[model samples]
Target: MSPTPSPESMLPLLVDYIVAWVLICTILFLGAQRLKAKIQFYAMQSLGLSVLLGAIGLAHQNTKALILAVVAAIGKCIIIPLILRYVKRRVPMNKGVESYVAIPTTMLMGGGMIMAAHYLTNHLFYNQSHLFNEMLSTGMALVFIGMLVMMVRKKAFTQILGLYVVDNGIFCLTMATVFEMPMIIEMGILFELLLGVLVMGILVQRIHDSFQAVTLDELEQLKG
Candidate 1:
């Protein structure tokens, strides 16, 4: 009879699966054209991240991981998305997505960056846990794609979402590299993100109200 697999043995595979799901969500976010679709993809990616943290907590019996997972879910998955939806409703301008690069070209760039991320991390974290390597690679991919979105997208709202994606990447990298951070620090990071999102949302709404549009192109008239 085949022997039963231990949780320790399965943990790496589970982590890889969740990270891959998050990466896929990131790619979908890159391809998404509508503000609503982008918000949904970002929420899904963050939900995967929260789940990844929860799984790590369960496998390692770490209370901090569990707390962080819950906080991430509340802040990234729920509250942030709600704020985005509110912004979408208030900002009637730029209902269609606008990008400096075509979607196909952006997707190709995103795919290439994912490969580059894996290639870069594969050697550096070879001595560490395999799970660390997977998480780091996915984190790098998220950051790359997020920055791409910020650079190519013309809308303030999309850029804000891209910033959130980069933030999420940083979160994953922190967890992979330093899993035992103080609970207060973790809570502080999430609180700061929540506060930043709120402030950015308000600012975006103000910009739309003032300029009558949210696209960066439209705001170029403010140039001195």
Candidate 2:
């Protein structure tokens, strides 16, 4: 008879699911047309990433990883989304996010990016375990997707959301590989991200107030 699978044995599988959830959220973020929907997707992605980190922490009995997970959930999933919503309310702009590229084309590019990420990870970490490679590749793919969003989306708010995605991706990479970053370093990163978001939010509001639009193309008139 086959032996029952222990929780310890099942951890890698659970991590796979959590990582998949994060990737799915990124795809949803890419496909979503409305600004609010994209923001919500980013929040969901953050929550999923936190879960992944927590799972890894628990598996290894690492206190720092667990604490980082909670901080990530609170900062990324809750605070950032609230700030984004507030910015949305303050800014006068179209409800829908304008894309420089068509949805299908963007999705194709995203798929290609994922493939590229996988290739890069495989080349760099050929000695790593398969699960580790998967996690790292997915994390890198999220980073690429975030950059794509920033490039294709017209609104400053959506660009900020993309930046959040990029930050989450970096966190994922760290959690997957190191599994335990120093508390001071993590705190500094969190503070930097929060400060950046606040500054960007203020800049976005000011841009809207001064230029009457928040789209990069619109803001480019000031480049002179």
Candidate 3:
């Protein structure tokens, strides 16, 4: 008879799978051509992170990770997306997302970056815990792809979303390295991210309202 799988033995697999889902969501966000689709993918990606954190907390009996998971769900999964949707409604923007590079090319670049991230993480962290390696690799890939999206997308709103992606990447890195991080620091980081997004949303809306344009190319007219 086959032996039953213990939770201790299964935890790493679960964490790796969730990390993979988070990375996949970022890739989907890269190719999403509609603002709504992009927001949805970002939310899904954040949710995956939240779930991973929660699972880790439950498995290890870590209250801090559990609290952070709830905070992430409230902030990243719900509040952030609502703020984005509200901004979308308030701003007059095109339904189709515009990018300097083609979707297929962007996706290929994202894939290459993911491979590079895995390679670097494996070489540098071969002796680390599996969870650490998975999170670190996904974190680096998220950062790389987020920067790529920011550079290639034309709209200011899209750029802000890319920044959020970068924020998620940083959070993943924190999770991998700072497993015992304090709650105060975690809450502060979440608060800062929320505030930054709120400020950027207002700034972008004002820029669009005054200039009647949201794309980076259009906003370049501000150069004096």
Best by lDDT: 3
Q: Total clashing residue pairs per candidate? A: 0, 0, 0
Model 3 score (lDDT): 0.84
- As a whole number from 0 to 100, the lDDT of residue 162 in candidate 2 is 78
Q: Could you give candidate 1's per-residue lDDT for residues 1-224 as a string of tens digits?
A: 99987866788878888888998898888888788898999999999999998998888788878987898899888888887787677655777779999988998999999999999998777787688888888889888888998899997778878888888888788777555556645654875567576557676657567665445555686773
Ranking by TM-score: 3, 1, 2
RMSD of each: 6.2, 6.4, 6.2
Task: Please list the C-alpha lDDT of all candidates, in the order they appear.
Answer: 0.82, 0.80, 0.84
Show model 1 residue runs off by greater than 4 Å: 1-6, 183-191, 194-224
Model 3, 147-195: lDDT tens digits are 9988999987898888888888877887776566566446548755675
Per-residue lDDT of model 2, residues 23-129, tens digit only: 88888888888889988998999999889878878888888778878887898889878877877776666889888999778888888998999999999999998
Worst 10 residues of 2 by lDDT: 179-188
Error of model 1, residue 27, in angstroms: 0.7
Identify the runs in model 2 with alpha carbons over 4 angstroms from their true place: 1-4, 180-204, 207-224
